[model samples]
Target: MRFYTLFFSLFIFSCSEVVKEESFGDVTTQQPSIIPAIQVYASNTDTDVKNGILYYKDTPYSGVYIVKFKNDRIKSKSQYLKGIKEGCTNKWYADGKKFEQRYYSNGHKVGVHTGWWNSGAKKFSYHFNDLGQYQGSLTEWYNNGQVFREFNYVNGRENGAQKAWKANGNIKANYEVVNGERYGLIGLKKCFTVKKGQDKVTR
Candidate 1:
């Protein structure tokens, strides 16, 4: 009877030790580590982040994907649903200033998107449609708070007047796109001719 009792106690202790070791291993492996924003952006074309969706171990990821700066400050925080980006994704500069704010729905960009310079001045603002195409006016400003550029887009193609200004508020480019052709002036020079299917302004 004594031998049997001792064997039973030993067996229970061994099992408990095994269970504790396994639990610790699991915890360490499952803990997620913060990644850098530059690394994440570089990996955007990889399978894990392809098509604006996020995947982990070949499975759709659903959670907040966060990236940090080298200084440990939060660089960006984006929410994902069933692997697709959803809701607002916010980004910050290394100095903790808000850098960009954009919205996504079902992996597609939607609504207004805005960005700011490190100096806290608005850098750019634009709108996107549900299909991720540019819609409405897109405007950019210099770090000194001067208007830098303005253009209108319809269905992702530039249309109407396009204008750009230098940092000192001097006119840089003033042109118009009509049916995929450019006309007017660009920085005191005549606008270059664009083919019927090649209406694009080079910044």
Candidate 2:
């Protein structure tokens, strides 16, 4: 009887120790130490950012994502599936104004993407299909809210009249594109003077 009781106590202690070790291992592997967000931005270039370079605890993020400013303001957030960026990824200016909004699927950009100037005016807007092909109107505006240029795209190629406007709202240029080639001159007579068989228009 004495020997049986001792063995039972030893068995209980061993089981508890095994459980504790497994729990600790799981926690350490699942919850990694987060790094400073500034490092992520620094890895990007001066004028643009290339995605998939962000890291969490020295490991690439592969799950739901939320990056915040030092002041606790949300700077950017998005979702990831198996290391591939998915769903809406959004960023904001320091003043809490939205700077840009983009959608991604399977790590590729898709759907409508929009950007705004720091002054709260829309800077540009465009759309791409699920296959990452541009398939709609692309528009850009001056910081003062005047239309800067407008063009149409079909399957990533220009397919219609493309036009530009000056900051003062005057027509800057007008031309047509068919099958991605400049079709003809349809601009100001003083600006675009076409010569016979020359295939050239001077501005």
Candidate 3:
């Protein structure tokens, strides 16, 4: 099962120049990708900077970046030390079960994010915009892989009317909501089926 989560952070640089501060702990350097306009913003051991700030300008990267370490066996990983989540960050439980996994964007939580519950019986997933809004394909599922509920948004709020399905493969009902209020041609019955999927299983 896959779960999604969203997280954000604010990084305020004090001056015009970026400082490279080597993070303390046992960090294993993974392969760095060929970043386009090569700009060595900062390093872990720099006198002028108090922290490391890695930046990007349009090129793509492929690899893991081990930045901070809690112990010799594990490390805190991130895709963008400066900004942009190029990879994934994962955490493990004491029982050897994967506890969490979060993707990043410029170190901010942006895009399709998923996670698990403590009971391990349910799964959760959500979407986010760059500035912090649930913006895109958002969905949830039961432990057995059945969809609990699935939806999305443009800026925020349902972009269109909410549509439900019936087992015979038809539109069960459609509701148009505005300003969190339901109104106008308030409801419609199942009469059509545009395409097919699990949504069509009974509809």
Q: Say which candidate scores most in lDDT.
A: 1
- Model 2 over residues 14-88: C-alpha lDDT tens digits? 755552111110122222222112223323333122364544555555544655677767677665554466666
Per-model lDDT: 0.72, 0.66, 0.46
lDDT by residue for model 3 (80-181), tens = 443444445655444434445665556566666666555564466778787557786666655565555455577666755555443343444445566767
Q: lDDT per residue, candidate 1, 1-203, as tens digits?
A: 99999999999877555421111101221222222122233234443766655786576676667777878887887756777777667888888888998878788889898999998899999999889999999999998999889999999999999988777766777798999888876554454433222334433
Which residue ranges in model 3 land beyond 4 Å of their true spot? Answer: 1-76, 79-87, 117-122, 144-146, 161-180, 183-203
Model 3 residue 142 CA deviation in Å: 4.0
Q: Which stretches of model 1 miss by more than 4 angstroms?
A: 1-52, 190-203
Lowest summed lDDT across 10 adjacent residues in model 2 is found at: 20-29
TM-score of each: 0.66, 0.62, 0.40
> Which candidate, 2 or 3, has the higher TM-score?
2
Model 3, CA-based lDDT: 0.46
